[model samples]
Target chain A: MMAFIHHFTKTYLMWNEGPMIWTSDVLILLTSIGILAALTYFKKWKWLWTEWLTTVDHKKIGIMYLIAALLMMFRGGTDAELLRTQLIQPGMKLLTAEHYDQIFTTHGTIMILFMAMPFIFALFNIAVPLQIGARDVAYPYLNAISLWLFFFAAMLFNISFVFGGSPDAGWVSYPPLSELGFDPGVGENYYLLALQITGIGSIATGINFIVTILKMRAPGMTLMRMPLFTWATLSASIIIIFAFPALTVALALLLLDRTIGTHFFTIAHGGDPMMFINLFWIWGHPEVYIVILPSFGVFSEVVATFAKKRIFGYTSMVVSLMLIVIISFFVWGHHFFTMGTGANVNAFFAFATMLIAIPTGVKVFNWLFTMYRGRIRLALPMLWTIAFVPTFAIGGATGVMLAVAPADYQYHNSYFLIAHFHQVLIGGTVFGLIAGMYYWWPKMFGFKLDERLGRWAFWFFNIGFYICFMPQYALGLMGMQRRMFTYPANMGWNTLNLISTIGAYLMGIGFLFIVLQIAYSIRYGERDLTGDPWDGRTLEWSLPSPAPHYNFAVIPTVESRDAWWEMKKQNRTDEWKVKEDEIEPILMPKSSGRPFMFGVAFFVFGFGMVFHWFIIALVGILVVFGILAHRAFEYDDEYVIPVDEIKHVEVGLGRL
Target chain B: MTTQTNHTGEAVHVKHSAKQYIIGYILSLVLTAIAFVLALGHAMSFKPLIIILMILAAFQILVQLFFFMHINESDGPPYHAIGLGLALLFAFAFALMSIWIMSFGYHAQLVS
Candidate 1:
């Protein structure tokens, strides 16, 4: 019934959408009111702890980011499922084109901007600080703010459904389609404002991570000595710093065009649509690395740990990751092979795209060699890692094919491209994240997840993913386009679509099993965590289960690639520290409700201004300046950690 | 933690500081004001002025990076690496803008 209302409202708006809300908008209005109403009744509003929200602790922020991202994933995933079902039978009338439009757009928006990003960030929050032997990220309060801003953006994206409708202009929101005369709905408004908001948060987070990685390495842990995960993050964060601002500028330009008609990308007004495409892909191409490279890092660590071998070719792996970053910037043109840039341009980009495979292949070989001649433990995480290796390679092979300029003509906009991305994304990033979750679950929480349940989850998920996506390559070859809600049954796509949908359900069930495993482990699972339960190689495994707010009592130094392993081998020396180093009172940022309030401000200003709420926008801008001004004059005057206090704390390390 | 105290004379330091940020901002602001005044005053003859201001702004961002952002003063990685990092971002943005502009095939100059 709700879906029907959403569907009906969307079609009506497609025909006659306005700045104002229609009657169906009231349903969204009512549902949002209902959700907020429940929050009020339960008084969970107070439990929204401003103290916790603004704290500098990476773990808390990472977890919050994950929670927000999960909500987005659910919202995005449901949209996907709906689209798939609509596409199952041609001209089936299950959903109108407008309804399909909203689903596809929101799915891409939420998945990329919200789900994948925050999930990767969750791993960063949990690992980077701990891995680098830093007590906290470089700017912890900023970290908190970045997370809240992201949440605000995610919330604003969803809030569109309530106030009016969400972005139906597609995730890319390509113009003239996005211009006022064409869309002129709250849909594109949400797209610009939400993305602009989230893009700011992402950019700031990128800077924060990059600074942390560069500056906060433990003494003796030079760039060369850093862990693979840290190295991957360094490269990824570099991409983010350089890349996301292009998105920010692009979205800003588009917003200017749509809201005020400034003629940036409009064809009639001296604007260039190809400009938008170029800028978007400049960010978009590296955005793939932003997701995939971190996953590669995750798999490296997993393979090495389970294989009980030193990561083979550590220097080469780091060098390769760096090379990947350098090469990625030159390859943005490959995205627009269909734009008719001529064969020379196309061939140049095509070759650049394939060059990425070299460093990527090096990293792959290094991982495999790490596993060679070692006692390979077939842990669930390791199983996923193994499956991912071959699967991602297949995706890479297809990617190379697509990079061939002539071949891309046949493959562009087809299900083949879709199949290629999903193969890599699911097989690479998704699998790596799942592997990290399993590998670190016991380290993060006190208990180990049920291995039996983990195995079931793995097999089902791995098999189901292939079943779903492998057929899409063939579908692409047969000339089936993506984003079609319905196809002519004679086009030979119905069987593949049906099979894909079935596989999606199986994958869904597998996810459920994993979720169940996490839930059960949280409650009744066995707990024996003196924290280093896995006998892990990294410093993160040295800390207690569910690590404390202050991560390290004494910032541990490095003697070798595996700092913790080196410590054990050397018989637990204070060689972890430099000689005459006196413990200064390590100052941590104070917890304030400021980040949340600032986030609220951006939230109101972004969404409200998009809808042209003059007064609300005014208030929102005031709130932002108000918070920043209030924050600037004050300081974290609370000298919270005293020197003797830290020493005492260090003695009781693992107390958390 | 240390400044370039190795500068031979107080006049040299004073001159570098004066030219680096203080005059840099002034010159940038003047060029911008000139461009803005021309545009606002409706003078098509000041197309040269617009080009001049943009070039000035681009240089100003560089000046600020070197002096205010403290890039050129230090010989260490902090100075060079971060400068390089910022340069990389600039290069990517510049490359993207160039491609975008060129893609329209001189059609932008034709856009009203």
Candidate 2:
């Protein structure tokens, strides 16, 4: 009764006051408190705050990132369900336009920013070091710090629903619309602080992966010889390092505009709104590739593995990804074709956008060849990869259509555009992430997700996703604009809308079973101590289940493609011995709470700015720096693995 | 960070001293001033001025990559990756700005 009342009150608070979260806030707040209390009740706080939050171990940090992503996925998915419900009947006013605006806004924001980005980051953190046969990333402390910063940012974004309003502006949070005078609510401020806080994490993550992939590869694994996933990870990191700083500056300027009344992006005080668009899209353009490139890399691995072939076009796939990264930066202006820049500008952006499809099309062909005729396993992960090509193609085709400037005018700001992006984005990036979870679950925790339930998830999610979104494309083509409250009933739209809503609810049920599937597996999943449970091709599967603190028994020499699988076939797991004599005490950085504390302080300052608490914000800034400075000088806290212990642990054999 | 197998173990030593790094910083300042002066004259003719500044920027980029970033030749594959990264940045610069400046008048209005 008490929990129900608490949920009810939270929901009431959410609907009555949480601005952008107008309707979603209630459930999210209760869930947040529930999460906190549950962790405390289970005495998991110490484990979470210590072993997870402050740990410099790449694997732990990766798990934390995924957990954060999972929680936000629920939040975002609920918002999706709500929006679908609103469209169930054309004339229904179940959710007001104000509520609807916040609903879709939060849905997009939470999905793309909060969910997809972290999921990619989590994969990078977990896989990169292990695949290279390294114990940890080049800068493990920085890796932990980055995850903490992201978590802090995510927490702040959610907490805003309780303390104040959420941003109701679109995910892009365009200028003029986002200007303080125009949006007197606290919502955009929520958007600003949350993203800026997370932006720090994103930048740090970029640097961490760059250093890890660049600095920490095992011997003989040359750049060309490195896995394609590593290449894609490195490319994506570089994009983040350069791209996110642009967003950071833009958000900071917006923060200044909102609180200190600066002129960075103002129409009133000699500020140019177009500059904001440029800044936002500069970040926004690269962001598309940032999310998808890693997934592209993942799909390549997935297709090759399931087909029992060497990746068919490795060189071309890498080249295509590299080209896609470059082209991604150039296409930001397409988002603003409606801003009336010029015909020449539109045509140029349009042309640039169309050219990208060529490389992307090449990637599709590569995956197709990988699956052409080899012994195909319809594993859940493979099923996703198989389904993704056709789905993302449809999405990509619609993207090219949107690129046509004259046609975009009709589609711009309509549900049609929304449908298009959600298709490519969800189908392309999000599905890849889901597939990744299934593919790598064994490697991450030494247990596979139950295939029976897993298959159920795959089919339900895949079919339900298309059912939910395909109709939206039709609805969009029917001249329905996005972000509206209610539509007239007799417009032939109700049936499709009803079917789409049913699809969403079914997806929700499908997702629930998936979660149960994971929980059940964690409790009773079949354990394979020998890591190559899937006959894995990568170095990661060579390691033991629940990999050791020092990943490799001894850092091994990587001499070929499919390094581990080759080593396994050659019976050379013992070859790590040749280098074991040279092994000295291995040093790993100690876990420190300073980074998490700094993240908290940054959040405090961010909140202070949101509420116009000048002194509090100032203190918050100081606290952040104070934590950073304290971190810079400490050199003595690392743990060392003695040579004797190394030998005891079969130093002759490398795990992967 | 260059990934490397250091059998010699002390493979990443650089000949440049701290004083050389300081000198590099000073040289950067002088180069920046020269670029700025060359740029001011060509403000109205941005094409030439931007060309000059970009050349200067390239010099700065190389200086940082070689001196500051220390893409350690003895270490790993990072040097080539960094070079490729720079090349990609140039591609983005050309691709993005060209789209901005060259295409300015055809079907810019999307609110039909």
Q: What is the DockQ of each candidate?
A: 0.14, 0.24
Residue-wise lDDT of candidate 2 within A1-656, one digit each (tens)? 99887775564245444344543456666877999999989999988877776787888888888988988999899889888888889777667777688777788888988999899998998888888877787777777777877887887787755556567888888788888888987778888988988888888898878877776777778777788788889989888987887788788898788888898788677787777777788888889889998888889878878888888888898899888877887787798888877776778789999999999999999999888888889888898898899999999999999999999998897878878988889889988888888887887888888888888887788888888888888888898788877789877888888988888988888788789899989888888777777787888877776677777766677899888778778988666433545666666667888877878898888888777778998999999888777876775757777877766665333431
lDDT of 1 at A232: 91
Q: Compared with the true structure, what per-residue lDDT tens digits does model 1 show for residues A1-656?
A: 99887776665343255432354456667988998999799986766575366565788887777677667766776777777778766667777787788879998888888888888888888889889887777777778788888889888887776456778877888877888878887788888888888877887888778877776777778778888998898888888878887788888998888777799998787888878887888788989899888888899889888998889999999999989988887788888888876666777789889999999999999988999998899988799999999999999999999999898999898999999988998899889888877777776666888888988889888888888888889999999998887888788788898888777767777887887887878888778557776667888877777776677656676778888877867788444432234565655656778888888999999877778777998999999999889978875423367766766665565241
| Model 1 chain B worst lDDT run, 10 consecutive residues | B1-10
lDDT of model 1, residue A540 = 86
| lDDT of model 2 at position A156 | 75
Alpha carbon lDDT at A408, candidate 1: 94
Off by over 4 Å in 1: A1-51, A573-585, A643-656, B1-27, B34-55, B73-76, B79-93, B104-112
TM-score of each model, paired residue for residue: 0.88, 0.88
lDDT of 2 at A36: 97
Question: What TM value does the first chain of each candidate achieve?
Answer: 0.92, 0.93
Against the native chain B, each candidate's TM-score is 0.46, 0.57
lDDT of 2 by residue, B7-110 (tens): 21424666777986897798789889998777665554868777777888988887776777665455433466655667567557845674564344433444
